[model samples]
Every structure is written in C-alpha cells, then in structure tokens.
Target chain A: MIGRPTAIALIAVGVVLTATAMVLPWYSTAYGGGVEVVVRAWGTEIVNKPGDWPAGELSPWYGVPVAVTAALLVAGIWVARAAVAGAAGQAGAVGVTAALVVSERGHAVEQQGDFAVGFGLVFLVAGTLVALAGAVAVQREAG
Target chain B: MKKVLSVVLLVLAAGAAAGATLLPFSELLISLAPGQPQTAYVTTGWSTRFGGTKDEHGPLFGIPIVVAAAAVLVGVRWRKVAFAGAAALAGVAGMLFVHLLNVISFHEAGNIAIDPGLEAGFGNGIWVLIGAVVLAFGAVVVHPDD
Candidate 1:
C-alpha cells in the first residue's frame, strides 16, 4: 500500500514531469528545408518539435492548463494518501489530462507535423498510468 | 431532503453546463457581427481560438458541466439512467468543447487554408439541445416532488 509520503512524492514527481512537459518545449518555428524548429528540454533545436499548441505560438501562456492539471494531480494524490478518495477526483484529473492530450492532437492536424501527436500520446499514456496508480493506491488503503 | 437537494444540485449543474456552452466567445462575436460576411471568417477564427477546430477544449469544459447536471437529474428522477446518461453527455461535451476551441483559434490566426468541414465534430449545438431537454424534464420531475 502507498503511504502518505509516498503518495505525495509520486504526485510531486508527476507534477514536476508534467510541468517540464509543458515548459520544456517552449517554442517551435518552421524554417523550411525540412528543419523543424522546437524548444527542447535541453535546448532549442531545428528538428523535432515537441507538441501541438492549439492556441498557437502567440499564446504560450496556454500552458496554464498544464499547470492546472499538475495541481489537480497533486490534489488527487493528496486525497488518495489521506484515505479520503473518491472516483470523482480521480476521474476528473484523468479526464482533464486525456482531454488536453486529445485537444493537442487535434491542433496538430493542421501543422502536419508528428511532434504534437507524439507528445500528446505521451501525455495521454502518462495521465492514464498516473490515474491507474492513484486508483490502485486508494483502493488498497480503503480496503 | 437528500433527494430534493440532489435534484436541485443536478439541475444547477446542467444549467451551468448549458450556460458555458451557449455562451462561447464565438457566440459573442457572432452577435456582435450581426449579419456580416466576416461572420464566417470570424466564426472559423473563433472555433480555432477556443480549440474547437481540432483540440476540443471548449467542448471539454462543457462536458463535465453537462454530465454533472445529467447525473444529478437522473439520480433524482431515475437513479439507474442517471449514471450512463451523465457519463456519456459529459464525455461528448468535453470532446466537442476541445475541438471547438482548436477550430476557433486556428482561424483567428489567419489559417484560412484550414478546412471548415470539421465544424460539426465539436458537438456544441447538440449539447445545448440536450441540456435544454434535460432542463425541461428536470423541471417537470422536480416540481411534482416539491
């Protein structure tokens, strides 16, 4: 069974990773020559843009949603750790993450670049994994 | 007392969902335009901005609102039906909202080359209809109890 600190730590890690996912790929620009300009976790590059931002480059502040999702994940983890868990909170966090990932993919459709699709899928998978783990932990504690 | 409160909660939730979806930023623009050619272009832009075009953010926001509403209503009026209806409505609403936002943002950015054919995908108009029906039914069901 996941203890309180362990649950909190997992949530913290998830939040940090999610935040990195949002902030790392800060920008993307296409300069022809098949060179895809993108901001990576390590540095900016001329290849492999990370994800699709439906709001577009003008509104990088849209990363607010990612931050919010991270907060929700944290809350879910806390609730689960405290043994005050419910399907609503867990479902809500998972739903939001899944929605965001799907939305990102939709936005990437116009760009015809694979970067958004790749990152979106990653987020979806990550969110699902986190949700499952949280649910399992909560169930174990509840039982 | 619990039953009454549950019904009230459901109705409120549905109403909130309806309000959000019905009051999209695009609707604001369309009302402001009031019969202009730019309406089409503006709508496209609005759709993209809100992620309606591809992302479905707009629909996503609306879904939970609708689901919570439906769940409350069904839970009160017909307990068994409440869960499935609520879940389905919420999921559909969420997906559509996201797509709508994507479309609005895309068009707004002068991405005119983007096809407007995916307009129906977001499901904004449909959810509004569903919400309205739920509201009407909920009123009838709750009034008798009161």
Candidate 2:
C-alpha cells in the first residue's frame, strides 16, 4: 500500500511543476535558414512575453497545459480529502499532461528542425511523473 | 431530480462533443512570406484524411466523448453507472488532452510544407468539449446512480 507521505509528496511535486510551467516559456523558435529577418512570434496566456505573433489568436485550447496544470494542483489538494475521487482527477491530469508533452515533443523532433523544448514542457514532464506517482499511491491506498 | 440533472449533464456533454466535431480543431498557417499566410481548417473526420493534412487526433477523442455521453444517458439507472460515467468522462478528458498534444505537434512540425516558419494551434471547440466533460464527470461523481 502507498503511504500518505508518498502520496503527499507526489501531489506536492505535481503542484509545484504545474505552477512553475504556468509562468515559464512554452515555445521558442530557432531559425536555421539564411533569412535574416526580424521574425516575430506568439505567446500563450501563462507565457505572456511580447513575441512576434499575437498570443491567444489561434484558439482557447492552446492554453490547455496551463489549464491541466491548474487542475492537477486542485487534484493534489483534493487527494488529501478523498483518495478515490482525487485519484480520478489525478488520472485525468496525468493522461492529458502526457499527451500534450508527447505530441509537442514529436512535433519538435520531427517537424521543427530548429526547435527547442521550453520550460513549460519541462514542467509538464515533472508534473506527469508526480501525477503517475500519485495515481499509484491512490491505488495502493485502495488495495 | 438527481436523475434529471444527470440526464441534463450527459446531454450537454454529448452536445458539446457534437459541437466540437463541427468546429475547427486546429488552424494551420503556411506562411512563406510576411503577408501571405495560407490557412487551412482541420476538422474531426474524413476531411483530415485529405487536403495535405495528417490528423489522427480528433476521432481519437471525439468518438469516446460521444460514446461515453450516450452510455451515461442510457445507463444512468445502473448501480455502477456513476463510476462508469466518471471513468468515461475522465477518459474523454484524457483523450482531448492527447488531442491537444497532437495539435501542437502538428503545428510545431508544420512539416507538411517545407516552410521554415510553421504556425499551428487549436480551435475553441476543444475547450468546449473538455469543459463539458468535466461538468459531466462532476455531475456523475456528485450523484452516482442517479
């Protein structure tokens, strides 16, 4: 069975990572071509730095990582009150976080020749780990 | 009253899922130049198969959301329906999350055209579906077996 300490620890780590990602940069560009142009970029809600492209122009779902991170934080807090219910929330967080990271990473590796993984991504990885640990803890508690 | 609420939630969730399908999931812009931005709409079905798009993401999440909503509506009287509904809703959330990932990658890679600058992002429909799934999950959790 999972210990309360372990569960709390996982939740705590997830909370911190998700929170950190909210403020960190999500994406950046690395131009390889010999085009010497002052290219502008876009930013997201959490990473609201003045980039070339206007932020929030694409869609609302672009801020999903932030939303999911916030939800993970809430799930971490809820676990203390109810393991079963909290487990559900944590599972959702883990699944979504993993999906977002994997897809983005795939794109970076495959599509973007001069792409860099951002802090938001790092936080997503950390949060996913914590969420997985928390899920295991909940299962252990139940078993 | 609880059953009615559950039905309403399920219906809303299903409606949102349907709406999500109708809405554009992502916008792909192939900007070869500063003002010449070619935009394309990525939907959830057969359209994605063609039109220089490779999106295997939408249906992955869309089908489940619709199926789960239907299940919840039809089986609300079951003893474990609440748990089932919760699981389904959660599953929908997870899939949608993955869907976003696919979108990011699609945009990130922007490899369809050998363009240096590839711009991609999700549409509003996804958030609507995700929010509806959360609401439906909450409703099930609050009153299971309704």
**Model 1's TM-score against the true structure:** 0.46
Candidate 2: where are CA atoms >4 Å away? A23-29, A33-112, A135-143, B1-23, B26-40, B45-131, B138-146
Best candidate per TM-score, number? Answer: 2
lDDT of 1 by residue, A1-143 (tens): 68656655555555555555654553344533465655332333445334442323332233443444445566666455222222233243335434444544454445664443335335433643554455456535644
Counting only residues 3 or more apart in sequence or on different chains, how many pairs clash (N, Cα, C under 3 Å) in candidate 2? 4
TM-score (second chain) of model 2: 0.69
- Give the per-residue Cα lDDT of candidate 2 at B9: 71
Task: Name the 10 consecutive residues with the lowest summed lDDT in model 2 chain A.
Answer: A34-43
**Model 1 reproduced share of reference interface contacts:** 0.04
